[model samples]
Target: MYADPRRRPVTFFVGERVYLMMLMWKGVIWFGKRGKLAPRYIGPFSIGQLLNDQTVVLDLPAELFGIHDTFNVCYIHKCKVDDESQILSLQDLKVDMSKKLLEGPIRIVHRKVI
Candidate 1:
């Protein structure tokens, strides 16, 4: 017999600050990241509004301009800002036409016969 661990779902409120999880499949391509150097999260934007129980609007800064502000709870993560220096900033990123990440291959995985 095993006891089920207590699991509590996280929730975000209006005016709260949170970071958006950087999804690799979303087509984010960092300037110098080729393999393991790529970052996993992108922002600590503030919540603009609560669209619903599962969605929140973010106040993205000028650096992340031209992108949508609304995101689901799954894409948002809690940020621990103990000090101002703890904040992170992404210098540059590249995306495809759909605004998803477009990174090149890290190495040659397969080769064909001549």
Candidate 2:
């Protein structure tokens, strides 16, 4: 592997909430909707059980009804919400199936040419 043996290993436990990395090629809508601007992690879903140090079962929401809940450690990351973590409500942003985020309409406040 490209990783160093001296580095600490990634770990997770049962009952911990984590964000699942969006992988797999399910067309542009799921994987490359925004090209490189797409968010890497999807949810802070709670872990139902730890199958091992490398995999865990997640309590996925209804939104992901068709997708599997069990995921590998490489596909999940621990979500640590600190004081600097801003709480965003669903009403704050508009997201479509294509994963396109719409903050608001685009307006040209000023224009300049060099």
Candidate 3:
């Protein structure tokens, strides 16, 4: 089939780290931010197990405990060793003990009154 030649097969192994695509919802806030600036993917989460050829379970952190662990291959991207900039650090986040994110003070860089 013509599709076969163009399609590339993606495989993931257990213990391999991968990034999971974050699905944007109307009102839900992913991580500490939301809207257009929000990250498209989160985690370099380790693969806990492969459920099927297309599905795998991820070892998500406690903060993301509410989300389902299983994900399809299309929803994940293999983590590259040299791409440190693509990874987001959870320690950089200002989360309180109650699992709430603390809002930092925002300063306006530019202002014009029309």
Against the true structure, whose TM-score is highest? 3
Give lDDT tens digits, candidate 2, residues 2-106. Answer: 988799987777777788887646552363335576567776778999888887899987766778888888888888875323534334567787867767744
lDDT of 1 by residue, 5-108 (tens): 78677788888878887666546545345456676667778899998889999998776675688999999888878575656455434666785776766458
Candidate 2 deviant stretches above 4 angstroms: 27-33, 82-91, 94-114
For candidate 3, report its TM-score: 0.68
Superposed model 3: Cα runs more than 4 Å off: 1-4, 27-29, 82-90, 93-114
TM-score of each: 0.62, 0.66, 0.68
Q: Go through the candidates in order and give each one's C-alpha lDDT.
A: 0.74, 0.73, 0.81
Number of backbone collisions per candidate, in order? 4, 0, 0
Better of 1 and 2 by TM-score: 2
What TM-score does candidate 1 reach? Answer: 0.62
Q: In candidate 3, what are the lDDT values of residues 1-114, reduced to their tens digit?
A: 556677778888999989888788665546656777677877788999999999999998888777888988999999886566545575666777896878885457698999
Task: Give the RMSD in angstroms, all C-alphas superposed, for model 1.
Answer: 12.9
Error of 1 at 14 (Å): 1.4
